[model samples]
Target: MVKLFNEPIILKCDHCGKDLFADSQMSIIVFVEDRKNKVIKDVYVCCKLECDRNLQEIKVKEGLIDGWKDLSDLTNPILFLNQIMATFNRMKNGWIFEPNAFEKLKEIYLACAQYVMREPTESEIKRASDILGLPF
Candidate 1:
């Protein structure tokens, strides 16, 4: 049994929803690697061992990831949102951040704060409510 150094949380199987343990015997380590053989992120994971084929072939559909997704398929809005979050975290953590990036994010935050501080006109409030998917 390989050292499952990471704590395992029992997950419900997607197919049958059976509570499966995340152990070396019952699970495989999912790893992600870059083109240079460096791991970036390990995404999808299933809590079922593949070696028990001969014991009892539980038709555990090959839902095993062992791979990654194409990031290029994401939309610009989603990318922008992710960038905003990452930038925010970087600044909060006090990392060596770019001055220009900090200024831009500060501007965005200031503009938003200013907008929220001022009392909006009825029409503006209505537009805001509609934009927030609220019933107003």
Candidate 2:
């Protein structure tokens, strides 16, 4: 009798909340860089249309595109707020991040410490709460 082999899960899909196996054809990796600190962050998602679109939207909204890459420096207020919301969403969805992910998250929060340390305005609170199902 032959025994079936099961692939190990490497990570979770940031969009669909699904387990990503070692060789999932649908897996895609996106990098979010904190150029000011020379740090690179990774975002994992499946290659489904909705998932891909959501990632693209986040990039666009965060202004991480080719010419606007400086927007991801973590100093921009909008970018900082968005990153915090994204982290929150990931935690809310029970994503088990790797160690480096934690380090990057720590770097991000530290870089934006001033913003976090201060009182958030009513507008900021409203905008942060308005996560329209985008997976960061």
Candidate 3:
């Protein structure tokens, strides 16, 4: 497993709804794809080795892994969100004006708002709301 990020991120297992600390060794992130090679879903699991194996087998049987990706290391959501915001700001300031700019910025802003609102930490939610100028 490649270490993509050093900090831990909160995630919930799609199958069991169990809280998963992405920095934990037992955590697994799996991406499922259809036969045509389009990604369909992403599954996060924090479980024992046996459970991980079982999930892989089940997904294989369902033909959801024609070309799949598995990663143990994940980026912290807050950091990722901050990066997104920074990139959006840079683009807003540097890029030529486009008709879709408003829509694109709105999309990113709404994504940040939703993520912070759903975050488990109150501090994170409040800070993100304040930074994004969103009333939560």
Candidate 4:
């Protein structure tokens, strides 16, 4: 998942297509498929918080609210990755992060690298290296 964010890519509101930047007050909702795969279903950016709430209600009514959570709550990288891989034996679409959320993904990858390097087994080191696409 090599996302090129070289330029200032303006993200849009998933519902209204309004221009949104990284610093905007936005809400990101991820949909988890069977507790194994996660996909960003929407990124709601609105001037009023009520608009974002309204959109979320609509999604709930449409049954698209399965395993949804606030992006801010995803603070634990290892736990987040574990949940994404809980039922799946192999990695899949859940491993991907939305382009706007690339910074968070980088942080998680870095955390994973640090974790695995802390008194890691040979095999664990290799696995982490492979996952991070780094030559260890």
Cα lDDT tens digits for candidate 3, 1-136: 2211233334555456566443345655443444344333433343546656767776645656623222232244565466556546745655332334344334433433433444436686578678877765
Model 1 residue runs over 4 Å out of place are 1-75, 104-122, 125-136
Local accuracy of candidate 2 as per-residue lDDT tens digits, 1-136: 0111122223455677664333345544455544343333443344445776776666534433312122123445676677678767866765555567576456435534443345556665556657543221
TM-score of each: 0.23, 0.33, 0.39, 0.32
Off by over 4 Å in 3: 1-10, 15-18, 66-72, 76-133
lDDT of 4 by residue, 1-136 (tens): 1222223234355566664333233544334222333544333333235546666566544434434343322334565466446524323534444555445434333433332333556787678778987665
Q: Give the number of the best model, judged by TM-score.
A: 3
Supply the global lDDT for candidate 3: 0.46
Candidate 3, residue 7: lDDT: 35
Candidate order by lDDT, decreasing, is: 2, 3, 4, 1
Clashes in predicted model 4: 0
Kindly report which residue pairs in candidate 1 clash with one another.
none
* lDDT winner between candidates 1 and 3: 3
Going through the candidates in the order shown, the clash numbers are 0, 0, 0, 0
Per-candidate Cα lDDT values, in order, are 0.36, 0.48, 0.46, 0.43
Ranking, TM-score, top scorer first: 3, 2, 4, 1
